[model samples]
Target chain A: MNRYSLNQATTKYWSLEDVVAASAKADLSWIGLWREPVQEYGVERSTKLVTDAGLRVSSLCRSGFFTSTDAAERQAKIEDNRRAIDEAAALGTDVLILVSGGLPSGSRDLDGARAMVRDGIAELAPYAQEAGVRLAIEPLHPMFCSDRCVVSSLGGALDLAEQFPVEQVGVVVDAYHLWWDADVYRQIERAGARICSYQVSDWVVPLPADTLLGRGMMGDGSIELRRLREACDAAGYDGPVEVEIFNQDLWNAPGQEVFDLALARYGEHVA
Target chain B: MNRYSLNQATTKYWSLEDVVAASAKADLSWIGLWREPVQEYGVERSTKLVTDAGLRVSSLCRSGFFTSTDAAERQAKIEDNRRAIDEAAALGTDVLILVSGGLPSGSRDLDGARAMVRDGIAELAPYAQEAGVRLAIEPLHPMFCSDRCVVSSLGGALDLAEQFPVEQVGVVVDAYHLWWDADVYRQIERAGARICSYQVSDWVVPLPADTLLGRGMMGDGSIELRRLREACDAAGYDGPVEVEIFNQDLWNAPGQEVFDLALARYGEHVA
Candidate 1:
């Protein structure tokens, strides 16, 4: 129970205040957050709310779209990521997840786009380390390879992460994005201390039209969540196991109900 | 155009006879066939029709669902694969593409299911070789890893194919399924003579409700078709390049129109 955290996206409809209140009332030790809501509610005010409620922030949702071909746009994205890192540091969380953007619009240069991801991360590594935050690269599923994230596998993420200091850059192992990989266990073992966050969500099929919102609640699909969590543990990751589902049905449900269901499912299927 | 083959699935609405006639009319030297339509139209009749029309059969669409958990069911699948090998030989095509089935129902044992695929292929290798048929393992995209095929990468397919003689087993390099893989080019180079089939299809975004029908025409989406074709050529695959798309819009369009577009796109984007 100490290791379980409800990511803000899982209860997306909940106000930041309500989620903090619910986590504290539920006697949870950690809560995961998203940048937009935290900024909307004022970063300092949101930080104080969680701190006063006796809850720790596990991680900030994301910050990385460094696949832009335009120099100015890419630089602006990097600057935005720096702000994200500072926000994560202010909230007292060391991890800021990154969903590297896909190929530049109207472009088919996959290798070039991936090179941009590596270069972008190289530029951000020093700034993140100084801010006491880690840029955790999250590999979206391959279906999103063209439009969402160029880094589509943990091995690819690690390839990028290994070029920098372990404290500076890390990889995220989200089950929804990675459970389909045959090499996942081996990659998890290789990840070792570089695994900054372990997010959980089920992969139900006949995926909804909007694949982004197709993630199922834990145990509702085919993922071996507990086994993955155990592999992460064996690989030296004892961080908060954040439940980060993005399903429309779950999002439409009451936040408290969804949060409670997530907690229960995590205990049964992932903890 | 000697290397161009029109896989019948791209013109799903066309009868086997119509596709054969169209391919011959278009001055194409090869045509790809699917099991259901070929079997439905009578394999011998279909074979003679294409043979007489001066069109050679490039490959057989599919024949492998070797991930069953039951002992009897596994044996039955192996027996069925033997029949498919005979059909391929009868059609005078050496390549019999296989889409290894997904995990068994109510099972999360991916490794176990994959082991079943290996064992089933092992059981069929000798029979296929004797029939002059090569089992071409087609690695479906990772999105289909849970429901369509366990072999989710060309590397994974090679890992299986290498266990048998090159004449008995080989791998299919389909652009739509493998374009997202960063290691695909290296795997293709390593494939060398193990590359039995080189398939081309573009990958469009906002995939439809049924992802199986989401493949775009050669020039309609994000894949680097010409580059992939060149890689295959460098890998010593001088065989037919099959245009295999499964778009709903294409299927709904006139078969001749779709066929003509595929031919034109192949010259522009793949050939």
Candidate 2:
């Protein structure tokens, strides 16, 4: 329980205040937050809410879609990521999750898009470091390779991160995005101190019509959640395990109900 | 054009006779086949039809689902694979593509499942070698890792193939399944003589309701078809290139039209 954290996105409909109250009440010491809702509730207010409730923010949800071919638009995205770093700093979290976005529209230049991601991170690393935040590169599943993130494997993410200092850039080993790789265990070991966040979500197939909502709770699908967590722990990641499932059904459920169930499953499957 | 082959599944609704006649009329010298349809057309009869039309069978579609835990069932599948080897030999094609199926029903032991695949191949290799057929492991995209093939990358497939004699085991580098990997080019080079087949298909996004039917015709989506084909050629694969699309839309289209379009796309995008 000490290491368990309910990423607010697990019950996405819950307000920041409601999630804070629920986490504190449930005796969970850690909570993961998203930028939109935190900003909506006012970052200062949201920060106060969590701190007052005696909970720590695990990580800020995301901020990196640097897939533009146009120079001005690219700079604009980098600026937005700068604001995300500010939010992460303001919220007192060291890790800011970065979802390197997919290929630019009307282009199939994957190498070009990846170069842009590397360049974008190099630009943001300084700002994030000054803000006392670590930019965590989250490699989305390969299905999203064309439309979501070109950094589709942990190796690929590490390739980008190795160009920076470990404190400036790291990786999020989310079970949903990485469980399929044969080299995951070895990569997890290589991740070592570079593992900024360890996220939990199962890969459920017959994925939803909107595939983004297809993540299942810890024990509901094919992932060996506990085994992966064990690997992360063995690789020196002792951070809070963020249960960040993106399921429509869980979102529709009562926030408390979803949180309680996630907590229980995290215990049974990921602990 | 001598290097181009129309995989029968691309025009799936076309009768074997129709496809053979079309290939002959179009001046194509090669055709790829699937087990079920060829069996239905009668393996010997189908072989006669192709040979009579002066069309060489490029490669046989598949045979491999060595994922069962039940002993009897596992042996049964092995026996079925032996039949597939016999069929491939009868059709006079050296390559028989294998889609190693997903984890067994309700099984999450990926290592154990992969072990079964290795053992299954070891058990079948001698028989395939004697029959003069090389078992070609086709690694589906990582999206199908759980329910289709755990062999999800060209590198992973090569890893498995390296365990066997190069003449007894090889791999399929389908552009659609492999285009997203950052290491694909390097892996293709590593494949060398182990490249049994080079399949062409585009990966269109906003995947359809039936994800299996989401493969696009060569130019319809994001894959760098010609680049991958060139990589295969540079890796010493001078064999016929198979166009094995699984799009439902293509199935509903006229067969000759689909064949003509696929051939044109091969010239435009994959040749």
Candidate 3:
């Protein structure tokens, strides 16, 4: 079955209550909740709303900005991730998506920053394993390599994942990020069953901004979503095709309208 | 010895005559000649002017954009690059830099575009080798992944190089493009003597524009030039440090003044 999951950020204009009601109204069987929304409604209430609506938590929004040189900061990040994992487990999310952060302050040594990320993940893997939530390391686009994430390739994420047990460490192949990678298909195959989630969003060829908020809607941009879906399906990833858009324009629209657009686009282009 | 080369675009306000005079006055050992300047001066006069000024050609400014999917278009690019190689040879350049082109039209398949680039390089390799010029693949910043070179990493370039004999393929580690790569040091080690040219420029964290024209001058931005030079030196790469800035503001300034600033920054920050 081709299931469509609405990542809450697409309609960030809505409150947690608003999103839950809208998700129920839209008849979306799956939804990805963010940290702020979960915190706002309290995890128990958020979990209850999902249960009541009969909606599955596709995955938690994120958990891993693990790129720090300081020991205390790194430990704090790991602890924060542990909380995120606990929340994912509570929400019955199968995966806790991780976005490895960028270079530490004043540190131009990229290799050193990457080692810190690996160590930070290694430190947190046991707790994630014990919590029953798969840690999905999402490789952000190379544009975010400096400020947002150092892990900018599926190959790099897989290299990091190889350090941990397969059940605990997996990768989220977000099309918007991995679409520009030359080895996407090969890496997707390499990821195989370890791909915890497959995400879809188009790469707006001419990015309007350099920050995180300029992502395009699934079909509005230039990415060949059908080909990406074919690759993911071929790789045995029979998961929800999560619609994750970080566009400011989409976020400003009404929740139901955004949800409807995503659903329509999914059916028309992605499915 | 630390050798300095002025990339003509850095002092774009100057004509070819002014650039040659400025280099002579600056006591700079070399200058990277661009196509526009060459065409303006006629290749014969351009080569003679540099020779008269006792300046060497470190490299020809560029020659690749090989992302066109059509065989004829791709072949035209190769032919253009061959002409560039001849230009480089006439000027006694050690390398003809190749800026591998962006995503082909109507295509989101980055791997396929990269394969086209590899084939383009393979076809151009013999022409370059026969002319006694090395083809240096300059991996652009990831921001350029879509509309520019899909080769966004030193590792990616090295991986491509492994497809051919080592002597024919090499990489240009431009600090602006590769300052944020996690595997830079390891890739540098892997590149070893294949590191044909080292270009320096700073990465302004929040890029002012999506285009390639806003590049920051060496000490004005975040890149650690001395440290990168140390890494290159440690990896047994003793090459001339070419200053390549693409700033509009700097380009508007007097050419001699820009050269003075670049030379001062090069000595203070890079030497």
Candidate topping lDDT = 1
Provide candidate 1's TM-score on chain A: 0.99
**Best to worst by lDDT, what's the order?**
1, 2, 3
Model 1, runs deviating above 4 Å? none
Q: Write the per-residue lDDT of candidate 3 for residues A145-190, one digit (tens) a residue.
A: 7677888788889989988889989999888887765567888888
The positional error of residue B144 in candidate 3, measured at the CA in angstroms, is 1.2
Residue-level lDDT tens digits of model 1 in A32-144: 99999999999999999999999999999889989887999999999999899999999999999999999899899999999999999999999999999999999999999
**What is the docking quality class of candidate 2?**
medium
- Lowest summed lDDT window (length 10), candidate 2 chain B: B218-227
Clashing pairs in 1: none
lDDT per residue (tens digit) for residues A128-233 in model 2: 9999999999999889999999999998999899999998999999999989888899999999999998999898888887888889988778899899999999
lDDT of 2: 0.92
Best by DockQ: 1
TM-score of chain B of each: 0.99, 0.99, 0.96
List candidate 2 segments past 4 Å from native: none
CAPRI band for model 1:
medium
Q: Per TM-score, what order, best first? A: 2, 1, 3
Worst 10 residues of 3 chain A by lDDT: A205-214
Clashes of each: 0, 1, 1
Chain A of model 3 scored by TM-score:
0.96
